[model samples]
Target: MQTIVYDETNKINEQAVQWMEDLLNFAADKLNVAEHAEVSVSFVDNAKIKEINREYRDKDAVTDVISFAIEDDEEDLFKEFEGSGITIPRDLGDIFISYDKAVEQAEEYGHDINREIGFLLVHGFLHLNGYDHMTVEEEKIMFSLQEEILRDYGLKR
Candidate 1:
């Protein structure tokens, strides 16, 4: 499947790695992504995420995650790489999360860091797999999927 590759320049603990992998697997299973599919995620601070949100989305604030799907000729989420049996790396795009925000929200929500990271990972992965909360119905589906994934990962607190 399209695995979630983390950009670790921002510093990630072991739990962050585990949660990232788990959430990617969760999304792959639920989305029925093929073997060797690919996805990527980046952990950023509030300042970096705010810059991304503003530059790409024209929003002037730090947000949870943003998804940019790499479209193919057939408009499939993931593209097939050259001649390899593997499906095209989903290029599933990158997710930018503010560690500051995650930690802050975790404190506010009264949950462990692991659980909070798990939730954020699931939320970001869902966005990569074509999930969004831009509308009421979209939110229901996206959140339900996120909750289910997190529950499966034993992240609920």
Candidate 2:
């Protein structure tokens, strides 16, 4: 059971939400996950996200999206998850998306807002799933997965 909660109304990003569901299911299939998971996504303004970033990460900037992974601290949460190949989860976490930034980026990139939202949702989901761009190779894999999942959901270019 995956739950998506918004901090505010997201009446505009319906396509992105649908694509996110597709991406989540694709990832679960690829990872062989079969259990309940909850993820919250917040549509916040730039100021709110900037405050969150500064308070949590000490970064005084408004980012596009942010994800908080609580599983990293739960030792027993995945006692045999990797070995037994089982998906056991209750609440995955939350994904905070800045709509202001998203709109700006969409226009700057000359792409549909839906595509930009899809990209952001995928990026945030990757982070929650333990994907990071700390290195070039890691970045390639994460980004590749992002594009692949989006393409799979018919979110072209």
Candidate 3:
């Protein structure tokens, strides 16, 4: 698993970025993602994320994190490539995290910034893998899997 991280706010340090990479690789292994899968994670300020939320989700409020899954749209495209003997890295999708919101939520949830970021990353990764919390049962399953992943990754609240 290859996780490309872009800290648009320039507030996150190298250590945190590396930690996120390691966490994502661990999560990918646990989730049975292909070894050559690729994902991009961007850390931006609340303003940029709010703009994205408004544009993509039609929500005016600022959210903590958002995910854009490539497979959601091009599932059949990949299936065509599968049996063609072409080796291509699976582009999972993109994850945008609000750095400002992360700090706020970390304080609100009584956790450190790393923990909050890890939670957000795992949540976004799950979304990329077709996990959703739109219904009560879905929320339970998704949240439970999130907790399990976090616990296994040594990031617990």
Candidate 4:
């Protein structure tokens, strides 16, 4: 799978972007996404992320990461990736990350900004792959898989 990193704001550093790319590539490899599968990661400011969160999720808050899936219908989402008459490379989804939030959270959590960004990217990718943490059970599964992917990628806090 290919991950394209875009900096909507000039806040993110090159190292962070490169790390994001590596983390996403690692995630895609572990999750078994198509080699041609495309996921876009945009680094934005808190204002942009808050706007997106309000517009898409109906929550007027600034989140560290937000995902926009291609297919809201769970059943049809993976079908597009199966190459069932689909000609183009699958556009998995878009992941928006707030650089400001990443920095803040990293400092708050006592971890490096790289690890926070990696976590957000992996979390957003999982959401794109039909993972959610709304409930207790879902949280357990999603977080466990996330931690596993991060550990396997050698990105630990």
Better of 1 and 3 by lDDT: 3
Clashes of each: 6, 0, 0, 0
The TM-score values for the models, in the order shown, are 0.82, 0.82, 0.95, 0.88
lDDT comparison, 3 vs 4, better candidate: 3
Order of quality (lDDT): 3, 4, 2, 1
User: Candidate 4 residues 27-145, lDDT tens each?
Assistant: 88888888878999999999999999999889999999999888577566555447566656678899999999999999999998888988998999999988999999999999999
Deviation in Å, model 3, residue 43 alpha carbon: 0.3
Show the colliding residue pairs in model 4. none
Cα deviation of 2 in candidate 3 (Å)? Answer: 0.6
Candidate 2 vs 4: which has more lDDT: 4
Q: List the residue pairs that clash in candidate 1.
A: 1-36, 1-37, 2-37, 2-38, 79-88, 80-88
- Write candidate 2's Cα lDDT for 1-157 as tens digits: 4757574644546665665666666765564554577677788999999999999999999999999976776565766567876666656678888988988999999998778877888788778778899999999999998888788777776
Q: How many Å off is the CA of 128 in candidate 3?
A: 0.1
TM-score between model 1 and native: 0.82
| Model 3 lDDT per residue over 1-157, tens place | 9889998998988888889999999989888999999999999999999999999999999999999999976547467677788989989999999999999999999999999999999999999998999999999999999999999999989
Question: What lDDT, from 0 to 1, does candidate 4 have?
Answer: 0.87
The candidates, ranked best first by TM-score, are 3, 4, 1, 2
For model 1, the superposed segments whose C-alpha errors exceed 4 Å read: 2-10, 72-87
Computed on alpha carbons, the lDDT of every model, listed in order, comes to: 0.72, 0.78, 0.94, 0.87
Against the correct fold, how does model 2 do in TM-score? 0.82
- lDDT (0-100) at residue 8 of candidate 4? 83
Best by TM-score: 3
